[model samples]
Every structure is written in structure tokens, then in C-alpha cells.
Target: MPKPVLIVGAGLSGAVIGRELAEAGHVVHIIDRRSHIAGNCHTARDEASGVMVHVYGPHIFHTNDDEVWRYVNRHMTFMPYVNRVKTTSAGQVYSLPVNLHTINQFFDRTFRPDEARDFIQSQSDPSIGEPVTFEDQALKFVGRELYEAFFEGYTRKQWGCSPADLPASILKRLPVRFSYDDNYFSHLYQGMPEHGYTEMVARILSHDNISIELERNFVRSDAGDFSHVFYSGPLDGYFDYELGRLGYRTLDFEEFQYDGDYQGCAVMNYADADVRYTRVTEHKHFSPWESHERSVCYREYSRACGPDDEPYYPIRLSGEQALLAQYVARARFEQGVTFVGRLGTYRYLDMDVTIREALDTARSCIRAFADGLPLPAFNIEP
Candidate 1:
């Protein structure tokens, strides 16, 4: 009998890789430190409200990759979901992404798309030829008024730092739409799993050759047991933080239940410096397909990740990036192990991207085995 491949972390990365390898005639053993699967994307039903709550905030799967979209759909049904984000700033509500309608409403004028575009251009900082920081990017893209109202406070609270301290790439993710499209993502396929993310992941790992163990903490020494070990845990944790811990921002969700609708929306950003929490997410609105009289919500608070805290977002500042490069060098020298997933790579990856990379990683592993070569430490660059 051939030795089984060991997979540490039963999230989408581990699950997808395990499924693919199993289908290709490899016994795969998956394990996660968390009792449940899906990692941060874990979703479950609230017994009190009967609403499917995103245990660690909401995760709406949106992607342009047809292969990844079709792959997930094969396991479970996906309900169409368009994320229309709303923000409250200075006692006024507004649409997110700073659309044309938002511009007109903010200034109380009927400006056409062209007029709005020209007005924004006039308002932008002409002195800033190149944006080097998050603050510079916002001022250059949307001007001061819109940036202050929509991004400044929210960003400061979310990242626990001044917008100026962050890299310009952080604000580049947000788009300034010319039209009144409130949809958060431009992906062709966007939806939430019909049952839940956990169920979808569970179904994916239901192969005869794949065995999953929950609450199983994996260590570096465990690599001796399997033919090859695919680790999806934090890269720093894998090396016991010998090069010092990589900086990460963790979240604190203050969950509360209310009768009827709480905010009448899935997510509402509190874009005021006085507002302690970054945003409040109403779980019921996440799955509009289901109706519920009571709603569950979470007021999200962001802070520096402690040793015991679950890391949510990687803060890839200059210092952290330098430290990561050292770890990457160390990882390359490590044998019989490959680091995979968001935490392993120390980057913020969406659900679709995670699945796509996992699929590609699995294919690379298979090819390496067939060619009588060792698998590389990372299929996707960190």
C-alpha cells in the first residue's frame, strides 16, 4: 500500500487539494486546528434566530474564473447574491464605491456621468503626480470630500493605522464607478452557498480516499508520517516564528440578535472616526433566499493579532515583507513539505482565488510525482 499524503488545515485549500489528489488515486489525510471546516469562511445556522450566520463575518463567493465557479457548483447549489454595500457617514447614508448617484446625492446636484467625472478630476490633488500611500491614492482617485466621508475613518478603524501608513495598493482594490452600479464585485459569477460554506467544504472532502480529523493541531515533525505534507497554516507558525512573527490584523465580532431586520442590509460601514467598530453585518440579509423574523448581527472590531488570536488579515508592510522573504528562503530549504493557502502565503486571498490556486497546486503535485521530482515549497508565489 502507498503512503497517504498529509494535508494540514481542512479549509478550502486543504479540501480542494485533498479531493483532487484522492481522485487521482492518492490517499489524503486532512486535519484542521479549528473543529469546523472552511476556515474564516465558515457559516452555520443560529439556533435562536434560525438565520445562517457567518461565524467569522460574511463570505460571498465572487469570481470571474469559470473553472473555479464550475468546480464549487459541482459540490453544492449556489444562490445568486449581489453585494450592495451601504455606508453611514456624518448622519447621512450613501452607496459604496463612490458611484455617480452617490456623487450627485452627496452634492445635491443632477450631474451626468461626464460632469461627475470632470468634477472629481478638478477636486483631485494635482500636486500628487504619483500616489505612494493609501491616503495619497484616495485623494488622487476620489478627492478629499469623498475620501474623508467614505474611506478615511473606515480604513483607519479597520487597519488600526492611519491611511497614510498603508500602501497605495490597499486602496486600489476599490473602484470609482462611473455608473450607479452598487454591486461590490465585477465578477461574472457571485453567490453564497445554498446550505452554507461548511456544508460545501464537507461535501468536497467526502471522498473514500480522504479522511479528515477536526481539532488536530499539526507540527513540523508530523511531516515524517506522510509521503508529502501540504501545510495551509501560517508560514511563521510552521517555523515556530524563529524569524519573529509576521504582523497580522485580527477581528473581534460582537454578535447580537434582534427581532425583525436590524439594519435592512447585509453590511453597513460606519465611516465616522467616533464609531469604534468598522462595520456591522446583518447575517440574515446574507441569504435573502431564506426569510426570517429575527436577525443576527455582528459589530466588527479590528486590532493587532496576538499570539493566541486567530489572524484574519496580513499586514504586509515593509518590515513584514522583509521578514517574509527570510521565511521564504527557509521554506525553500525544507523538504517533503509545501506551504499553501492565504495564511501559508501570508496574503489576503478571496474564496475563488483560494480554490483556483489549490486546484493548480494539486495538479503541480501530481505532475511532480509522475515525473519523479520533488514538489516545490510554494506553487503560488508569496
Candidate 2:
């Protein structure tokens, strides 16, 4: 007596849940609007360059969660990837995340550990007890100089708005180290999937009972056969935005092939507002193990996600949360339906976070069935 399941949107979150349920002996059916399994993490090798380019953009996998790290490694071998992010800001290129090297390079002073700490402390604004805005938080941590140089313009470019309007929680960590540690991530485990994300997802979804339909027309009424329907598509689209549309930011990546090496690094962020394009990613470097004679490059651009734009980041504007509440309320009232993952929950999530959340959600569902606990509409809170 296996419970039939219907999962929409074959993204990482949906894939994770669908796979888990099928492994637990539940019949599962998964569908995606796109022709691929991996949502944004999809990677395909360019036939011309022999370079595995991130179709959406470069996604660097970095996380401190040990369980998540082990889970992903079980499927694919992860290679070492150090995100030495270089940024062009104020007529000069510098290392990002405001490490010791960046501090030294920008200030034109060879400051030792103590000197750097004291110098930075001198520049930081002490008056602000609690940070209220992105600008306030950045200045409080990295000071006016670094904030202005590194974050201000980049934030503007990425958000298509001023940092001053953004929430302080965004600057949770600026990573000011005493040592000259320029490594971007402080995670215990960090690397890219050996076979790329598409394969990783393909591995996750490979099961006897699970059937995946790609580039399929998804109508909510069409999913009536299943006992429980898991919706991972846009929450608005899920409910047809009975209330109103939630705000979001989308990316526009302009790509081209280069004869040889275009940029030495995999990621070069344009922190200064002077550059029209925010960053140039050389996809070849992402796969350092495989040497490509030629290279592929993508100039990353940020813009407002219009009605038709592929929404990347959830804006969560003032009344949007209330609007989200309306959707959640409607979802709760609906029978045999669970809303999980980024789009369904109306929040941006990293791959690792999405995977972990899906795993936990699956476990929660199984436990709920065993212990007679109630299953939630959401796997994770927004």
C-alpha cells in the first residue's frame, strides 16, 4: 500500500524529495517546465571549446554543514575549488570579501595583523549599535572606505537598487581576518561536483518507481490522481497569484567564446558601477582538471525581474510577506498538497540548503506517517 505522490518542478529541492520518497517505497512522479533535471545548477560542456559552462551562471558550492557535504559527495566526487574572486572597483582590480590581501592592496600600506585590525577599527562607525540597512552593516564591519570600494557599487549592480534600502541581515559576514587568508569560504567542505550538477540531479532522480517528465505542460488539475501533490514551482503560479505578484531580481548573462584564455580566473566581479556588466566568468577555469584549449565567457548582468523575467532572488518587499501569507493560507486549506523549496516558499535558497531541507522534509514526512504527526505545508520557513 504505497502512497502515490506527484511532485512538480524537477529542480534540486523537488528532485531530492521525489527521490527520497521513492527510495522509501512511495510511487513518485516528477515534472519540470525545462527539459533538464538540474534547475539552475545545470552544466553542459561546450562542444566547440570543450568547456563545461554553467548554463545559468557559475555556481560555487560552499557550505559548513557536514551532513549536507557528505550527502552530495555520496553521489558525485567533488573537486577542490577555491573561489579567489577578483573584483574591479574604483579603477583597480582587487580580491573580494575584504580579506587581508584586499585591505593591503587597497590602502597602499603593508599593514601587519595588529596594524590592520587597529586601522580598520579606526575607520568603522562605532555609533551604530544595531545595523538597520545594508550600508550601515557594511560600514560597521568593514568601514566606510572598504564598504564604498567593494560593496556599495556591487550591491547596486546586483540588486538594481541602493544598498541603503536593503536589510542589514544581508551583511551577516564580511570576513575580516587577522591572517592573510584569502580563501573565500570558511566551510569545512567546499568544491564543485565532479560530473557537474545536471548529472548529480540525474543521479538523484534515477529510481525504479520515479518517472520524470521534462518540458511538460503542468496544470494543477492534471495532478489529481496522486494522494499528495508537492508544488515547487513559483508560489504565485501555483495559486495563480490570487492576491498579487511578489517582487524578485533576475539575472541576464551575455556569453561568447574566446580563442584561448579570456580571463585567468573563473569569476571576476565588477564591483565598480562604472562597468555595465557586473562580472565576467571564464567557465573553463571552473573545470581546472580538464584543460580546454579554448574558453567560454559570460558577462553577468543584474536587472529587475519583470512579469516575464526568470526570477532568481526574492525581493520580499514590504507587503510581499503578507501576500505570501495569503498563499500559505490557501495552500494550508487545500487538501493533499505541500509547498516546499525556493519558488513554492518564495525565498532564495542555495543548492546545499535546498538539498538539506528536502532531506529533512522527507524524513519529517516519514516520521509523521510513523508517529501520526501532521505534515506541514512548508519544509522550511521563508
Candidate 3:
């Protein structure tokens, strides 16, 4: 019998890689420090409300990659879901993405798409030739009024930093539309797994040749037992933070249950500086197809990640990036192991990106094995 390939962290990265390798006739052992199969995307039923709650937070799978979309559908049924985000700012509710509807609603005027576009252009700061910071990007794109009402306070609260401190790339993810399309993402496919993320991940790891061990804290010593190690855990954690811990923002969710609908939406952003929490997400609205009498909601608070806290978002500022480069250099020299996934790469990755990269990494590993070459430290560079 061949030595089993060891995959640390049973999240999408490890699970997908393990499934691919196992299908190709390699025995794979996948493990997670957490007892659950799915990582942050873990979803389960709330006994009190009988609603499927996103235990960590809401994860709506949206992607433009047809192959990746098909890959997930093969594992489980995906129910149609479009994230129509709503925001409350200064005692007024508005459609998110700063759409034409939002503009007209905010100004209390009816304007056509072209008229709205012209009006926003007038509002935009012509002085900003090129946006370098998040603040600059917002001011150049949507101008002061819209930026202050929609992005400024929300961003400050979410990242726990001034908008000027963040890169322009952060604001680029959001689009200011001239149309009434309130859909949060412009992806080709958008949905949630019908049975829940946990079930979907479980099915992904259900191959006979793939064995999963939960609550197992994988260490460097365990690498000798396997042919190769695929680590999806935090890159810094893998090295015991020898180069110092990478900065990250962890979320504090205050969960509460309410009768019937709480906010009448899946997500509601509190776009006000006075608002302590960034957003409130109602779990039942995540699966609108399902009927529930009660709803479960979470008021999300963001803060600097501590040692024991579960890191949510990587704060890849200049300092953190410099530290990450050092870790990446160290990882390149490490033998018999390959770092994979969001934490491994120390980047914010969506579910689709994670799956796509995992698939690519698995293929590379298989090719490297066939060619009698050592597996690369990272398939996708951080």
C-alpha cells in the first residue's frame, strides 16, 4: 500500500484537493482542528427557530467560472439566491451598491439612468486623477455625499480603520450602478447549497480513498507519516509564528432570535459612525425558499484578531504584506509540504476561488508526482 497524502484542514481547499487526489487513486487523509467539516461556511439548523443559520456568517456562493460552478453542483443541489443588500444610513433605508434607485431615493428625485450617471459625474471629484486609497476611490467614483452615507462609516466600522488607510482595491469590489440592479454580485451563477454548506463539504469528502479526521491538530511532526503534506491552515501558525503573527480582523457575532422577520432582508448594513456593529444578518432570509416562523440574526462587530480568536479577514497592510513575503520565502524552502487556501496564502478568497485553486493545486501535485518532482510550496502565490 502507498503512503497516504496528508491534507491538513478539512475546509473546501483540503476537501476538494483530497477528493481529486482520491479519485486519481491516491489515498488521502484530511483533518481539521475544528470538529466541524466546513470551516467558516459551516451551516446548520437552529433548533429554536428551525431555520438554517450560517454559524459563522452568511456565505452565498457566486462565481463566473462555469467549471467551478458545475463542480459544486455535482456534490449537492444549489438553490437560487441573489444577495440584495440593504443599508440604513441617517434614519433612511436605501438599496446597496449605490444604484440609480439609491441615488434617486436619497436625493428624492426621479432621474433616468443617463441623467443619474451625468449627475454622479458632476458630484465626483475631478481633482482625483487616479485613486490610491479607499477614500480617494470612493470620492472619485461616487463623490463625498454618497461615500459618506454609504461607504465611509461602514468601512471604518468593518475594517476598524479609516477608509484612507485601506487600498483602492478594497472599494473596487463594489460597483456603483446606474441601473436598479440591487444584486450584490455580478457573477454568472449565484446560490446557496440547498442542504447547507456542511452537507456539501461532507459529500465532497465522501470518497472511499479519502479519510477525514476532525478535532485533529496537525503538526509538522505528522508530515513524516505521509507522502506529502497539503496544509490549508494559517501559514504563520504552521511555522509557529516564528516571523511574528500576521495581522487579521476577527468578527464578534452577537446572535439573537426574533419572531417572524427581523429586518425583512438577508443583510442590513448600518452605515453610520454611531452604529457600533457593521451589519446585521438575518439567517432565515438567506434561504428564502424555506418557510420559518422565527428568524435568527447576528449583529457583526469587527476588531483586531487576538491569538485565540478565529481570524476572519487578513489585514494585508504594508507591514503585514512585508511579513507575509518573509513567510512565503520560508515556505518556498520547506520540503514535503504545500500551503493552500485563504489562511495558507494569507489572502481573502471567496468559495469559488478556493475550489478553483484547490482543483489547480491538486492537478499540479498529480503532475509533479508523475514527473518525479517535489511538490511546489504554493500553486498560487500569495
Task: Give each prediction's root-mean-square deviation over alpha carbons.
Answer: 0.8, 1.5, 0.8
Residue-by-residue lDDT tens digits, candidate 1, 1-382: 8789999999899999999999999999998999899888899999998999999888999999999999999999999999999999999999886898899999898998899999999989889987899999999978999999989999999898999999999877769887999898889999989999999999999999999899999988888889999999999999999889999999999999998988889999999989999999999999999999999999999999999999999999999999999999999999999999999999999999999999999998999998889999999999
Each candidate structure's TM-score, on Cα atoms with residue i matched to residue i, is: 0.99, 0.96, 0.99
> lDDT for each of the candidates?
0.93, 0.85, 0.94
Question: What is the TM-score of candidate 1?
Answer: 0.99
What's the count of clashing pairs in each model shown? Answer: 0, 0, 0
What does the lDDT read for residue 191 in candidate 1? 95
Tens digit of per-residue lDDT, candidate 3, span 198-274:
99999999999999888999889999999999999999999999999999999999999998899999999999999
Pitting candidate 2 against candidate 3, the one with the higher lDDT is: 3
Q: Which stretches of candidate 1 lie over 4 Å from their true place?
A: none
- The true-versus-predicted C-alpha distance at residue 235 of model 3, in Å, is 0.6
lDDT of 2 by residue, 1-382 (tens): 6457889988888888988898888889998889877888899989898889899998889998898898888888999988887888877888766767788899998999899899999999999889989999988888998988888898998888899998887777667886777777888778999889899889988899899989985787966787778888888887776677887888998989988898789888888888878899999888888888898999999898888888888987667778888878887777667788888899888887888889998888877766766677776766
Q: Is candidate 1 or candidate 2 better by lDDT?
A: 1
Residue clash pairs of candidate 2: none
